[model samples]
Target: MAYKSLLCVLTDSDFLEAPLAQGMALAESQDAHLDVLTLGVDRSQNGYFYAGADALMMQEMLARARSESDDIEAKCRQLLQNSELRWACDSGVAQIADLGRHVAMRARFADLVVLPKPYGPNHGTELEPTIEAALFEGQAPVLMVPEDAKPITAPETICIGWNESAEALASTRAALPFLKAAKTVHVVVIDPPVHGPNRSDPGGLLSQFLSRHGVRVEVDVISKTQPRVSDCLLRHATDKSADMIVMGAYGHSRFREAILGGATRSMLENATMPVLMAH
Candidate 1:
């Protein structure tokens, strides 16, 4: 019901401040231990180019990676030095292809993983693999913070995107602590099917369930007037002045979402506020 251990994933990028600040703030607020993992990834090397001088090229790349990792670790320590929260900093070097598994190994021990938003102007595809690993391989809920996001000690108003899928259920369960602590919680259902389990009531069942858990909850059934369901959810959250949005991730296959665009991908790319997601 509460997060006792937190993991913050970082890379050797300029987008480190947001996730670090968010992680520390959450740890201070929840009275939890914080672990920081910085991954050093060098994308300048190609296997085809190192035909003759493989060993020397590999050695040089590793040395550069180690220096970057050390610098990142030093920066993390400097920022966390004065904080009273229990914390630790660690770093590793991994090839881009192996980054996901590397992060997943450490992510398995944490209650919740905090990560950088993988898509946006401030970020590239470097952290996308890591996020997928933390959610799917590690089987942990991930709180993604945008590069410009402000540190949230505790969210006051939260919006839950309800779809009655197993993934949504998992995310809602993972977000129970935040929902119970929030001043307001909105269960937003976007154009529910008239022939399904929620035919009689769109978001009523979920709202009732949350109310029993001491959540100040309400149901909002909105018509899908927008082009995408994510747009509707984001608009509703913004209207409600939500500090964070809680939703399931990748209800469809990752490859499908990547190629055809799904709600999860849209939310990840467009959400202005922090997003808590589980898969």
Candidate 2:
């Protein structure tokens, strides 16, 4: 029920400090082992066009990638050398399109996957695919940490975004450890259906289920005041001064969510707090 092994995946050096710090703090708190992976994108995978005319350009790109990887690995080792936590640092390069699978392969052996916020002012969109791969392919919960997030040994209050879908159930189950440790857990449901099986009482079943596990749980059924469900959830969590939010990722198809913009996309792009998600 507790995280014993944590994996931190870093693609570049732009927002490395926050995730590394967070991973180390969590590992120290849990007395667990931490593994840091510095992944570089291989530009030579798509250098077919430079076979004869522009081969030197491709070589230069490959050399740059190697240099970046070496720099990141050195930085990680320097930061982790003085720490008393059990940790290891490794680096690898993969094609941009296949980076997700490579990350997922390593993630399969870890209890929890720690990653930088894929969509934010401090991060680029390159990590989005890797996050998805870890969530779906690796079959492990993913924690996305913001660049300016305060270090937390454990969350005091948590909010769960509920929709009664299989994905939501999976995330809720995955977050039981945190819920059991939190002082209060809120199962927030927005605009519940009027004709579902639990129409008479929305979120009550979940509250009861959590209570059986010694969690101080409550249910909040609120109307959707904002255009998107994610906005309502974030506002409520902020109002409650919750330290973290746990919810399912991509309730809808990824393609549909990307094209039409679902709650998952909105939360990934705009959330200021740490979000733990599973598929």
Candidate 3:
């Protein structure tokens, strides 16, 4: 089957346009129903804890947030109106953290979720929490669009960063629909383990599995020493003119922080093409 339902998360941040356009384009290409979830902050609830002075300042903040939210909502509606695709729009008013959870809950019903790649450190807004929420809470594959991405289209060439991790398997399975449709599927293994349970012929098993699904699969083993695995993966994708990169997301424990795996973070920061990840 195909992606019959797609969820897109929108925010009043700098990274909105590309994902908005891509989401609509993707939904149109797949003939899928699109759901757009926009987030707004509601500070009214903070009134219970505020004194006279604090209450006045809080009211100003709330007013500003409300105005911003309204404008963003209108913009989203206008964008959707311009598109002929089947779409629905929903908005939530909550703290940013809770807003992410709300989006995640809605994402559970979707076949795929679309999001804008998080800005690099020093770049203003942060959206990784939202991405994390959607991936973990929704338990779904996420398609992250770069700021300069072209209008979405069905991927013709796909690169799978193979490591045989459970997350990688989940990503591959989630990407099967695209792989089966692609003209070429490259399973790229970088600096694979020489001998281990996970290294029983790196990429061979996955290639075979994909071949059985009628995909034109090829296994590529690259021996690179300098750049990181994530860098090599991106290089391979570029060299092959891949339209999409499907891989696993890595994460670790961080007290009150969303600390992502090195490879996953690099891919999110440096990828010029759409990266599909599952954790």
lDDT of each: 0.88, 0.86, 0.80
* Model 2 worst lDDT run, 10 consecutive residues: 43-52
Error of 2 at 170 (Å): 1.4
Model 1, residue 3: distance off in Å is 0.5
Q: List where candidate 1 sits over 4 angstroms from the true fold.
A: 44-53
> For candidate 3, lDDT tens digit of each residue in 107-211?
789888999887664442437777777788888889999888886576889999998889999999998888998999999998888786657688888888899
Candidate 2 matches the true fold with a TM-score of 0.94
What candidate 2 gets wrong by more than 4 Å, as runs, is 43-53
* lDDT (C-alpha) at residue 227 in model 1: 97
- Each prediction's TM-score versus the true structure: 0.95, 0.94, 0.89
Q: How would you encode candidate 2's per-residue C-alpha lDDT over 1-279 as one tens digit per residue?
A: 778899998887887888888889989988889999998776455644444646677667667777877888888899999999999999987667677788889889888888888986655455888899898889888888888887666789999999998778888887787889899999999999999998898988888889999999989899999999999999999999999998999989999998999998899888888898989
Between the candidate structures 1 and 2, which one is better when assessed by TM-score?
A: 1
Instruction: Indicate whether candidate 1 or candidate 2 has the larger lDDT.
Output: 1
- lDDT of predicted model 1: 0.88
Which residue pairs does candidate 2 place in steric collision?
none
